[model samples]
Target: MDLPAPDRLAEVLRQRFGLDAFRPGQQAAIEALFAHRRLLCIQPTGYGKSLLYQLPATLLPGLTLVISPLLALVRDQVGQLGARFDIPAASINSDQDDDENARAMAGATEGRVKILFVSPERLDNLEAWRFLLGLPIDLVVVDEAHCISTWGHDFRPSYRQIVRAVRTLAERRPSVRVLGLTATANARTEADIARQLAPDEATPLRVMRAAMDRPNLSLATVEAAGAPAKLAWLERFVAQSPGNGVLYCATRDQTAIVAGYLAQRGLEVAAYHAGLDPAAKRRLQREFLDGRWRAIAATNALGMGIDKSDLRFIVHVDVPGSITAYYQEVGRAGRDGLPARGVLLYDPADRRIQTHFIRSAQPTPEDFERVLAVIAPDADGAWPNLTRIRVRSGLHPTRVTVVLAELREQGHVEKVLIDRKQVYRRVQGTDTPLDLTRYTRQDAVRRAELDAMIRYAEGAVPCLMQALRRALGDDDAPACGRCDRCAPPAWADLPPVEANEGVAGWLLHRDVEIAGSRRPPMSAGLALLDGQLRAPPFIDFMRRRTQPGASLAPAVIDLLRRQLDALARRHTFEAVLPLPSRTWAQRDAVAALAAEHLGVPWGADALAWRDAPDARQGELLNNDQRRQNVRGRMGAALPGATEGALLLLDDYVGSGATLAEAARAVRVAGHGGDVVPLTIAKVRWRLGARGIV
Candidate 1:
């Protein structure tokens, strides 16, 4: 492989990429690839790392295979390559139809495709793997390559398989070159990535990292007491900011909460997260890019592959899990070498959200066995549907996914497509023991990273940007002198921004419609995080007021009373029935309040437990066990031929399995009207005996 002449490289750069000259380090990285050297490039977010491979594929002899971790990023890049640069590129991903994927494959085989983008998960498919191995691959690019190392903030299990694929390619053609790229890798993470991406043990990966100091950006950390104060400051800041921006939230629910609050206050904003449909996400991204929306309130799902250059601001409503994640997110600002600002509305309580995420990611060994047990093979030795496994095992869908990925990576299980859908099968006679040592090590590393992030937020150093750059392995990074610490902003010591009373009240008392199992069709509850990232007040409310003999707190009763008053405006209820529970006093209190609020009769003893055990519903692992525990054990004693909608009240709703059984009992007893559920909170995941919502 020969390096392109300097003149020829400039000619292609100008004509194909619409650029006059290469950014610093771009040419060097391209040269390393041309010489068939394994390289790892670490630069800031706006750096043109893509051109290192995209430009080379134009002059190279063979295909450039880009293995990325994000489906949205691959789709976005593939579209840009052909539309913007006139490069013949295609992508093969699960999001595409069979015809689309087949066309991509066929195009690659016919030598019409110069660059092919595929996701890391695609390598797990045997057919896709063999097809890639058969291609005439000259350059292999691993975008977001830090995901290959557990030490990285966003580690993906599928990325670890790329080395095997690259090794196979090099075994056939010694000219195959590998390039690994990331924007957020500390010294330790960089070493891990370099070690994993090397072609062989004797070969060292050529590391190329530009200076990470961004002088045009100003960094500041503002202290807010809680969510309400944070929301207040966010509202005031975003309202006064001049240009387009992004507001980062730690959870999907927070995205909606923050976005809705801003939108109600006359800001053109929308929420973006993984839960959104593809069409909505596409529309929102297009609108944001076109400057039709002022800002996007989003989770980290919007981080990688966003190419907007003129974003004026980036705000964090909650603390991120690590300094790497925080730096990567804030780097989205000041891309155009213009003065831009990044602010963190920090509260000590924000750390709870990141802590919850770390705890949830670590599944116990028993969780692995429970998930494995449900993946039984049929007569043909094919595994069952994963949806069934999730329901049967009663674990969170994400937990099941992690367990399966680990099982497959360790060679205890194998994945294959049956009728274009993925199914797993156990490796014959291979009893691979669970190795949890890695989980322990990873947990310790994550906690330490979080602690470092907290220290950074609390001003452990004099310069914010300098501290961030140093954390990302740039020891020589000088102080920017424009941040709050370097040159304190005028408002650095100002009092907390006061919020609109109505907005503050709404923030603390928003309502949610919980998905129900049957009959009710829908349920209602107070705002609470779906997972473990809940406020201490919410945890205390659920624990203290839902005890065996406790009653709803006065504030809780008032909140529920106000919630029902709003629900009354939507639909009319004939009577109120408290769902059967061992906490009789609380149920009675709620029934009295609801009955009084609606001016309707209380269906006392309308639902009674027959012979169900005393085990709590949250203690059960899966829907199957929970449903069976309550099935046929509750009898409804409603008036004969009862009519009209009935309000079913409970303390909380997790799986809604118990509620479904109660609804069935009501139907079986000749009630022939709607049954709407109302509760204090709606849980996203199953609550442990002492865990938060």
Candidate 2:
């Protein structure tokens, strides 16, 4: 159990990795590892954190086990590292082919692989642990190590098992070194890592923290009147920002809609979400990293394992559910230490959405009861077929396992492995069915966490860096002086708009009352006409123009002239183009108007609107009912708005209706400014271009 020489590690780094010097905090962390002391490295993004452990693995004798939270990263690291070093490296994950896994295990047994990357779930395999116990292991590195903490953005219950597994491994090989690595680790997460990895010995843990400051990243946020305003802000911000970036949407559908909107605007963008095929996601990632695309609109799935160092911006189109998530996502920006940006487009309504998300996440006592019931009986009167237990319990698989873990901790259940699957059995004749009622306190804690997250989203406090510090319980810390709030007010201010002179009289074309068929060109034509005609005049004309048993056709050139004149005065109008509007003269005219006045051109092939089926329309309307419960819960902390026009934005309008309705609510809620409702995408215009019907 001799310690590795420091010069040998340096030589490995130079010869194998072609490096000269350790980054800021890497040397101290590497020294601790060489001395066999437990260490945690809290380095910021793009600081070569991986090399801190990877370099040491090369110097240390025997196999180095790398526990990673992400399979993709493990595979990528093994692929990259194996090419440079003759010492073998292998990763085992669910994605690996059987032959590949067999080869990896063979390499491990042959003492050829210096590093073995595996997901935490793989460690649950008793046979794998048993086999690894026989190996001369030098170090165990936990990648994305923050996931070990319950407070982390991505907490996996399986990670808790690592403590016990490490203890077991230590008994077999008592001199193994343990190291943890992360890009972001607040105080809470750091303590959690220490407790899990080096709980007993005084000063067994050595923590090295790199400064969190990213001076090149400019943070900004837009507080909208409602959803529509947020969408409008996103449109404006993305249009102004330079280079490739990512827009994080809250849902898969929103990702698609935002990406579609940007694409329609002639920007090269792509969408990535769980809904896409894995191959498609890989392609999108490659394209985005290669600069073939200027932007990507995706859900949170886009960030992990995405190692592009030069991503210039990361925009959260919807506020995330937690500060940890927000920090991790925003931290993706400016990784190259060049000027970059992180923008959050938020509105009061977003809190309600997040609240619902949290409420839905509550794991009930019944979930625990069912899991115990399934694992109570097996051929050995033990838990077997864990996957079956998960499926039959009707609980989220992760939740089921978490509850099982709690039961095991309480000494109410025992777990063993038969083959590759987990086997669990309840303590025979134990009447108490894992009483999770005690977890009621945890619920309150979770509620407080949600409240904190909501505050982070809605707080008017300007300094994002300070806000983050406060949220992470580092209050009274000095301000970072680098975030949007700390920046000069003028630099962060929205462009000035003329008072009450809202996008001009473009509201005088004929109001065509649409019915039945869903056609994009027809819908666009209708919106154009509606925009041209004043609301009252349009409604009146629609009522008067409908003739019994007759097609509503009017070849009135004067009507178009009047609409054009109105548009010229204020640049606001609504109209309906005919089907196949590409050939319609008025369609081209509207396209020109949109390009010249509104800063968005109407594409001939773009979808103007979609008609939701009855079921979907009902769902869209139902969302309003759901929203009503949380509508009045938000209170503004900022001073009353100064007299000006305010535009609201949202990602999509399923009924092509909710934005204006929500805008009216915002106005009534004491927004003193003139309100304009907008959306990135509109759907179902058949009811009316502006939802008047």
Question: Least accurate stretch of 10 residues (summed lDDT) in model 1?
Answer: 524-533
Candidate 2 wrong stretches, greater than 4 Å: 1-10, 83-87, 125-135, 199-203, 225-232, 274-277, 376-384, 396-398, 415-423, 429-438, 473-476, 489-693
* Candidate 1 global Cα RMSD: 5.8
Residue-level lDDT tens digits of model 1 in 1-693: 788888898999999999998988888888877775689999998888889899989988899999986665566678789999999999997757688899999999999999999988888777899899889998999988888889999876677678778778889988888999999998998999889878778988889888788778888888786667877788778888879888999988788888878888788988888766556667787778789889889887774555677888999988999988889889988788898889888889888879888877777798788877777876787676666566567775556777788887888777777887777777778776888787888889899999989988888778899989998999988887888888876436434556456765765566655544334344333333222336454676666764666766666677788878877776678888888777544778778878998999988789888887546776766555566668778888887876677788877777677777778888888888777778776675443222225
| TM-score of each model, paired residue for residue | 0.79, 0.66
Q: Pick the candidate with the highest TM-score.
A: 1
Per-residue CA lDDT of candidate 2, range 1-693, in tens?
455566866677788888887667677778777675578888767778888778777767788998886554565577678776655799776556678888888888898899998778777676766766777777888888887776565666678767776777777777778888887667877887887788466646878776666667777776654433444555566677778788888866567556755665577877787555445666777677778988788877676566677888888888887776677778787778898887777766777656655554456776666766767465655455565565445454446667876877778887777666667766766665456654575456556666666676665565776776566545575666766567656345443222221112221232222211121111121122332223454444344333333322242234533433443344242321111211123434434433444433333432222321223232322233323323333222212443343333222244433333334344444555444333222233221012322
Give candidate 1's whole-model lDDT.
Answer: 0.79
Candidate 2, residue 686: CA error in Å? Answer: 29
Candidate 2, position 578, lDDT: 17
The deviation in Å at residue 9 for candidate 1 is 1.1
